[model samples]
Target chain A: MSDSLFENLRLELRRGCLTLAVLANLRTERYGYTLRKALEEAGLEMDEGTLYPLLRRLEGQGLLASEWREENKRRKRFYRLTPDGERMFDHLAAELQRINASLERIIAEAHA
Target chain B: MTTLFERYLHAVGEALPKDVVAADVTAEIADDLHSRAEEREAELGRELTDEEAAAILREYGDPRVVAARYGRVQSLIGPELLPYYWSTLTLALVVVVALELVVGGISAIVRADGLRFFSALDVAVHSLVWVFTIVTVIFAAAERVPQGRQRLARVMRWDPRALAAPSALPPVARSSSLAEFIANTLALLVLLDARGAHRVPLDRLVATMLSDLHLTLTVAWQPALVGTAVGAALVAIAAMIAFLRPQAAVVHEMLRMLGSVVAIVGLAMTLASGPLFDPGGGIATTIGYVTLGAAIAVLAVQAVLSVRALLVRAPMPTPKSARG
Candidate 1:
């Protein structure tokens, strides 16, 4: 398969998990660069441009709260989910589970 | 020495809104680019130059595109507000055009020779109205867009709590006396100064007054004067009611309704006493009649909306115990 095709598949797979990945990782206070690294380490690759704005919007929607802190002579903005965000994350996780189960059933039937 | 990569970073930083995207984001992006370039240099066993780093940055696309992605996560205004904005704009345009035509017809009657003058004035006013309408529509749309919303939020330094707070209706009932005073003063001045009652000068005067006064005064003065002597009396009553309650939304509704009534009355008087006040009976007369009529209609609609808002009670908040 071509590299472009592989890259497209990777993007589609990552896009599916992006929201869940962000909510899960933000359980700990982390800035943009650290969050990106953590997601990559977990096998979900995201670009800097995509991560930063998603963080801001999630924060805006009251799902996340952020504060700027200085550490090791560097300024970093750390974000964490609010109580509302936690509740929403649980709801979304359940919805994603139902979706995954449905997809698994359909694939199993096709193989059968 | 500073490299071309540094120059590119600076340019992007300058283009973006300073408040939304932090300095650290720029620094991190620059650092990442430098690291990438170094990795490439090591792989090729050659030193990467400033130009090569700049080339890599360029391939990443314009800084604005990157910055915009950050802001475009969600819309501010969404599709809901579009209908209301369009309806308001269309109504305003129709009323203004209708007024211009009526004035043109009237002027054509009084002055047999100066049809061209009326036509020119009509074109000029129409052009101005179109320009203002377009600008307002663009502004309203941009405010809804994420990038525009971010810029506006930065400029306005908006308080999120203000959205959750109960709406405070203006104390219209208390301010009726003040409204009446302003209305009566303006109406008497217009009626007495019937000397220069032509449309062009009077319209200019009204615009100038609206621009200078506070919002409360502007809403009150025009309506009280135009509707009736009864409108002036309503203004006093509205002001008193507004003052006594201070918190009641109804006061504002009353004042707005009174103001619209006065404005309509004043317009009627101007039309009825026409050419008698200004015998020039040409382009000026036509312009005056149309402008006054349009102004009245606009004020009347606004007043009605204000009253409606006042009369409607906002829903009560759910008690904390009820949620459990």
Candidate 2:
């Protein structure tokens, strides 16, 4: 039960971070497979189901733009951050840094 | 032969919500899956086997779950419209059942065949199924229109003061009058076209049915044409009156009764002339008889209702000062 609880909490924690990572990585136009590979290289491994749907939702929210184009003799849908998406990413990234700094400070004080 | 990969994509596509763009999503997923397989093949230095592809698909998650992530499965009829849906369904079902019973009963009595009741039961069940599907689809579609609920609410709003006494002539609804007018006009056109030199689609259909039955309706045309024309004309007159006056229930009902009687007499006269089709037996004959019987039964019911309406005493007109 404890293990399952930890796993659930871990997933909840990763969810927002993964979305943030996706937005950050999409600074360059990339298709699904390439994007996943990029995120994996950045130490954020996401399931296909989770990643694709998240991309779709972000696009639906007008934060991401996608278009089908030919690459390597095959059609692939490429996604990138829209202007609004760029602003949102910048805002969220700053917020994350502030939160991280506060968390580190609290942790160091507790340890002392 | 569909590959396991293709089948998996298809399954996912099937599980997606109606509103979702399944084709585009499935295509993207397919590309990703193919990429995964290619990477695995590169690692192993060979093409991946079916089992390896299956493993990849299995790792993704259940098709339904994967689809659920993309879009929610919304209710066809939402909670807001559910009560109205139920009420409409109930009313439609009651009308269908009543119609089936009456028509079936009359057909059985006329043919002296008790089995007609069974056929009627069969027809009733079929009609109920159709009615349920139609009503559900209509309501489901209606739910999608944001303004539909508001429109329906507005239509259903009632005024206590507008309620007339039992003796008062019920106000004629222009919409209903317009509908009646259109129905009568279209019917008259079909009848005239069928009788005259010009052959319409309805005429062609009748010709096909008659040909299939090895029957000729040349003898029956006169009575059928006469009946339909006279009946439709009377109904058209009633519709015009209703449209013009909007407070002539008595006149409308009387005309409607006269129309029903004219149509019934025409049908009865044709029926009295003997069998409509050449000697034949089986399901076709049963269908033909049931159709005729149902038509007569419907008209008879309409006539009875019209008579009842005529019998009701009109309410006394209120003085203009009292109206306030």
Candidate 3:
């Protein structure tokens, strides 16, 4: 039961972080394959099932943009952050830092 | 010559909603899967086997689940109002059952035939389905409206002061029991109305109804009707027995549940035989479809509830000393 509880909480925590991570990674124009590989290398592995749908939702929300192009005689769809996405990414990044600092202070005070 | 990759993509596309940009999604996924496979091939310095390729698809997830994620199927009935939805449904079902039984009992006494009561039951079953559907639709719509959701959530939230005091179970009313017994006895006689038996007056009522609705049943319907009659007879017998011996409550419930299963099978056979109404296009046909659908749904719910009662152990009488 505790393991299940932790898993539920872990998913809840990861849900928001994932959106931010995807936005951060997509600041550079990268296809689904390369973007996933980059994030995995950065220790933020995500399932293809999850990553692709997230990309679609972000695109639908106008936070990201995509287009199809050919490379090495194969068709691929590449995605990048839009202007609004870039702005939102900056705002969220700042919010994360503020939250981290507050958490650190609280932990230090408790220890002291 | 469809490759495993193409077959996987096809399966995903099949699961997606028709309105979605399935082509674009499939194309993107196709490219990504191919890229990954190619990368692996490059590392191994050889073409991958079909089993190896299938392993990757397996890791991806079930096609339908993946498609559903893309659809982002939000809950129609949100978590906040779920408890209220269930409570309301249970209340509605109880009221419907009580009202139907009482009406059926009264109708049987007046008409001097049990089929009259069963006719009332037929209407009750159909109405129950409509009630269920409307309630669900209303709650689902309410969930979409923020203000409505908040109001409903507030209303549903329990207060300490509002809690009812603990009370003992009420005694059974003998009058209601007698009424049910009479109704069941009448129903049995009417259902058993076959060759060399007194013809029930219900045939004329049924004929008039069919004529009004512009329906003409084929000879095939006779067997189905007979099957349902047999099932209803079983239920009636069970009810009459229960009324006489209250201690046989568990047996009564089980028998009733069994009767319902038989009745459901009979109803299904009726549907499988083909259209009950003659070939036509009008409001009557529409009504017929809705009535059939609702009746089936109502019976299915009845069967499920019976099973649930048995699972939870139906209320058995205990001696006063044992009650302590």
Q: List the candidates' TM-scores in order.
A: 0.45, 0.44, 0.56
Candidate 1 falls in which docking quality class?
Answer: incorrect
Model 3 scores a C-alpha lDDT of: 0.74
> Tens digits of per-residue lDDT for model 1 on A1-112?
7999998997887775897889999988887767887999998878777777677778879999988777656556778989999998999899999999999999999999
- Return the lDDT, model 2, position A49: 80
TM-score, model 3, chain B versus true chain B: 0.45
Q: Highest lDDT, which number?
A: 2
Write down the worst ten-residue block by lDDT for model 3 chain B.
B164-173
Best by DockQ: 3
Question: Model 1: residues >4 Å from true position, as ranges?
Answer: A1-17, A26-45, A59-88, A100-112, B70-78, B117-324
Ranking by TM-score: 3, 1, 2
Model 1, global lDDT: 0.61
The candidate scoring highest on TM-score is 3
Question: In candidate 3, which residue ranges exceed 4 Å CA deviation?
Answer: A105-112, B108-130, B137-324
On DockQ, who's better, 2 or 3?
3
lDDT string for model 1 (B1-324, tens) is 146777667766776655666575576566556556766788989977767766777776788777666554344344644454454455455345434533543343234223433483467477657956674766576765667745644554547656543554644443464565566535533432322233445745754653453211222223223344334334533443444445544644666586566657766666665351223455545665687778777867877787777667667587999779
Instruction: Give the Cα lDDT of each candidate.
Output: 0.61, 0.79, 0.74
DockQ of each: 0.22, 0.58, 0.62
Better-scoring candidate (TM-score), 1 or 3: 3
